[model samples]
Target: MSAVLDVVLSSAFLAAVLRVSTPYLLAAFGGLVAERAGVSNIALEGQMLSAACTGALVAGYSGSVALGALCGVGVATLLGLLLAALRLELGADVIIAGIGLNLLASGGTAYAVFTLLDDKGGTSGLKSGSLPAVPLPGIDSIPLLGDVISGQNMVTWLAFLTAPVIAWLFYRARFGFHLRAVGEMPDAAASVGIPVRRVQYTGLALSGALAGLAGVFLSMGYVSFFVRDMTAGRGFIALAAVFLGGLRPWGVFLAALGFGAAEALAVQLGTLDVPPQLVSTIPYAMTLVALAVYAWRRRRQAGVEVAASV
Candidate 1:
């Protein structure tokens, strides 16, 4: 109990949780956008990895984090557009195309990394410019809460703020209404001249941009260097968060935070007798538990609705 409390009470632990969760939060937001538009994007992993490597490579070589971020987001957005084009124009299945893109990204990113860094393993040795952390002005003067909130990466702050923006967009924005309309019933939406395809296309593009930002956060904010396959399937976890959150932005934020805390616990446990392998499973195990709970609640809600109707 003391050990756990020690870990929890440490300001560093809280900061680690925030940092670890940033990418997940960003990716989950992307998932929210994709699903809200009626197109379930499964290519999030590909987009993130592709953009991550590209962003890191650019930042390492050019020493311009901003330009690297643009390249990353642009590449990811283009990938999203390509998927949309494949689905909307070529009559391809979205899932299949997404899966194919993931496979392609694995190989493509590997090649890019090798070409840029002369190594297939990773680019951790590259002199990459990282995103700077912003210290809250006069925040340190406060006692407890200030320690937790101050000195976080600027991207982290932006990521937290993004949740409310997404929530607002879902409830208040005109685009949000169109997204729901197209997602719920494309035929109905199109009959009213809602331009369903255009909406989907735009939604996916936006999703890719968010995913790109997630990638940027991973390579440029969370760490100064890039590791091959560094995302380690967080994209899939974000998808789980999307479903677990019932596709709500704030809900996804909470879910992502849970996963991040689990990850932080795993890292903290590394100093203990726990096997490194077992400690690493904490995040994935939490994801499984979350999914189970989501399923149970969904079923319970459905049962309640049926009983009331009957």
Candidate 2:
């Protein structure tokens, strides 16, 4: 128990939390954006998987990390637009379409890797380079502060910045007002000339871009290559964070951070005498508990609203 406390209290563990939570923060914000636009993007998993695979392959082949990241984000943005088209134009169920996209991404990425690299596992043979880490020179000299915040990957920095940027967008931007209005009541927003479909499309595109950044970080920042199904349901976990945070930017930020901390704790606990299996389940277990609490609160709020109406 003392050993565990020491690990938790260390700066290294705090740094690990930031690193592990990067994808969750980015993807959760993506989910939040789509949710606020009145369209649920169930394709977040697919987008992340696709972007990770695409980013790795592109960087490996083109030898330009910037180009690969851009292509990866572009591909994810297209997937977002496709999801919106399916929901809005074809009248397809967003959930079903999103599931279909997820399946396609799973199969498609594996097949591409197999066909291109002739490997079933991943792009281990390919020399896909990792994104650069930012080293804060002055801050890096500070003892504990440097240990916690100095040499993180660029995406980790972006992930932290995203929370504040999203808050500004949500509370202070004109588009945010339209997005929230459309999400709460689309028909009413349209009656007031809000260009409902356009806003939804843009929101979904932004959502995909954010998720794509997360995916790119998975392959490019987290590691140097892509692995099959490497996202490992992080996308869904991020979706949970969106609801867990009450679909607000800062709330989602904290929820995603908590998930990250849980995962980091699980990793640290592995070095202890703890069972590896139990430790690995920590993040998912927390997700279930969070969702249950959110559901209960929502139900209670609805009950209160009904009583008030009566």
Best by TM-score: 2
The regions of model 1 sitting more than 4 angstroms off are: none
Candidate 2, residue 202: CA error in Å?
0.4
**Global Cα lDDT for candidate 1:** 0.88
Worst 10 residues of 2 by lDDT: 66-75
Residue-wise C-alpha lDDT for candidate 1, range 213-304, written one tens digit per residue: 89988889888777878889988898999999888888899998888888988998787777899999999999999999999999999999
TM-score of 1: 0.96
Give the per-residue lDDT of model 2 (tens digit) for 1-310: 8999999999989999999999999999999999999999999999999999999999999999988899888989999999999999999999999999999999999999999999999998999898999999899999899999999999999999999999999999999999999999999999999999999999999999999999999999998899999999999999999999999899999999999999999999998999999999999999999999999999999999999999
Score every model by TM-score: 0.96, 0.98
Cα error of candidate 2 at position 269, Å: 1.4
Model 2 score (lDDT) = 0.95
Error of 2 at 57 (Å): 0.3
Candidate 2: regions farther than 4 A off: none
